[model samples]
Target chain A: MEANIAVSSEKKPTWGGGGVRPFGASYGKMMMWFFIVSDALTFSGFLAAYGLTRFKFIDSWPIADEVFTHIPFIHGEFPMYYVAFMTFILIFSSVTMVLAVDAGHKMNKKKVTWYLFATIIGGLIFVGSQAWEWKTFIKGSYGAVKTTDGKILQFVNESGKQIALSDFVVGDRGDDKVTQTRKNGLWFESGESVGQYSVAQVISSYNANPSIQIRSEKIDLDTKQKIILSREKGAAELAKAKLVVEGANLEVNEYGNTIFADFFFFITGFHGFHVFSGIVINIIIFFNVILGTYERRGHYEMVEKVGLYWHFVDLVWVFVFTFFYLV
Target chain B: MAHAHDNSNVKRIWMVFGLLSVVTIVEVALGIVKPDFLHLNGIGTSWLNWIFIILTLVKAYYITWTFMHMEGEKTWFRRAVVWTAVFLIIYLVTLLLIEGGYLFETLAPLVRW
Candidate 1:
């Protein structure tokens, strides 16, 4: 064994010995890999918690299709269409990133610059799309009533198509309840923005509209749809209304379980923050490339390192797209 | 850094992009249609879910191997990075999912269906 070790040592110096590259990978790249692995575990933890909560509340969980059914520019229900477009944009940006790295390897400055430009544009569009999605989610399409027991009751027609609050609700809210902002109220205290409608108005409106039926948050396993109540049952359920919920927030969600919206915001917000920072880093690296920093160094290893990070962001989005939208 | 002449593999890069795009299209199509046969039956999840998970893995493999240039990486580097993640993520998912199932069973009676 000592003879063999001596022979191996005489042959050539191995990596991780006196500033040698380990695993044929540079120090920067290996550190980046370590970051990616730890980040992956963090994401996995979040997803696993989501899975556990979803399973625990399987019966009352919101259906993905029903909640995410909005498309920009168009008004009708187009579930997952915009989300798919966002996914394509992100993936396409990743392609451009790899292309940029390839150009870097070839020392083709012009191609690298242009590809990097394309990638930055793609990232901008994706971040914008995510913002728009968040806006749409916050401004819910079909408003619902929150009962005293913390249950959600949405309205639907006989055909089971969800009807917006504007479709049937008709009455003026007599109570003068304005939004309590920090500036308007005590400087040290504030409250959530007031909803568009009030519980009293909604209750009166529901009492007037006999055609509108109530749909509870609970899903019928056999039908794979939320349980819609009869007209009499609808009125009885509406009588328990404690507040009017127009959109989503940290506390209340018109879609279904409040925890769903909580996780949605936390996970996607964290991911979005990553994408945003990735763009900033890319821009810096893009400028460095334009200034011939890597070219002067006679290697584009910096570009390759950043490419790994960019691709990792894209990779995380793939799983996010599946879990949040597709599933 | 040495293989400057062979650095630009434009054709292979585009081919990988095409493959990823096609796979994404297939995933979206399947998700939208949600064929009844695939959605209704499975061991734990539906066959559709299994298909999605499998296709996602395929996409992940291609991205890591081709775009990330893991294909050209040394064997130990590849194993150190990929194998560690694969094993840990699977283990985490399995334990979490099993615990979640147990929670569901325990709380099934309390929650109104």
Candidate 2:
């Protein structure tokens, strides 16, 4: 009885210090899994919020195809192409990462180093592509006029092809309104950078160009296209214009709904940030392999742990691709 | 120590890669084409959207199972991670969607342009 009590006392009060890796897993690996579970919930929160807003604006949601139609130097419209390329890049990087982990298990340091290098390169390319996509989204192709009720009004040619602001608005600032700047004692510093032309210019150009028609944000479910106003209704709707919105910002977006842009920026930006951090962590582990740290320690479990994180990132992208781009 | 699992997992990794790549290509094609029948035929949700969701789940399954080596983990640990996340996500999404549909049904009419 005395001997039993001595052993029990030595191991008493081991309440919480994280050696409790359930299922005989290492402490580091189990903790990584915990962090991943929590982070997954965080992303789910954002995606569910997006679903809420989408449902609220179901009738007038912007079509993903119409909004994200741009690739560098290519002229014509090819929607979802660039986003699909990005998805492939991330997936390929994930493959390389898994290979690294597999190599690590066999204690093949050279293969692990090379595969980790490829994964890092893939991550950098994905991040760069996202930056490009954001640029294209913020600088919209076809400018739209905002109604007093804060809805977008786009211009379509007679044949139903969308046209840009510079296409028909050829005159120099037709409106006599002075440009607002700090030097001129204008107190409107709270606004985004001043647009090139005034609302009057867009209005006058739209009025003079009889070949153009107004496309409202509302959709016709049967045809799944934006409802275009007739010639007479077009003129009347143009009169309701309050401002000329060229590109996307918090205040306005040329796309059908401003909330679409907001969600796009937030969700994609957060995912990209995660990818960026994963790249950094992989680089740290890669150096450790070259320095023979894992060799001395007798295992390459660090690579395996980091691989879990990399695959988690790719898993998140799969959902993002489905919801954001595909559906 | 001779590891219990084979070190020749390179083949399995490539097979998973091929599967993921093929699935992604199919998804991108469907998105671009958006066939009329699939786009229109559903009780409340479109058939095309359902297909996309199902395919995405399949891809997610493989990624989690093979790439992350979840299949090699203990059964209890795997269930602990997957089940908790799935249940919570579904619960939250269902409630939020209900509230959103209510707003659209009741409040959208009141806010006139």
TM-score of model 2 vs. true structure: 0.92
Best by TM-score: 2
How far out, in Å, is residue B1 in model 1?
7.5
Error of 1 at B82 (Å): 1.1
Residue lDDT tens for model 1, B1-113: 42544645777788888888898888888888888778777777778888888888888888888778888788999898889998999999888888888887898788542
**Model 1 chain A weakest 10-residue run by lDDT:** A9-18
Model 2 lDDT at residue A248: 87
Worst 10 residues of 2 chain A by lDDT: A9-18
Cα miss at B5, model 1 (Å)? 7.5
Error of 1 at A58 (Å): 1.2
For residues A1-327, write the lDDT of model 2, one tens digit per residue: 546432343354444332454587776887788899999999999899988998888778898888888988898799999999999999999999999888887888999899999999999999999999999888888999998887888999989988888887867676565556778776675555657777788888887889988898987878778899897887777788888888787668998799988999899999999999999999999899999999888889999999999999999999988888888
- Please name the candidate that would achieve the greatest DockQ relative to the true structure: 2
Report lDDT (Cα) of residue A286, candidate 2.
86
lDDT of 1 at A324: 82
Deviation from native of the Cα of residue B99 in model 1, angstroms: 1.8
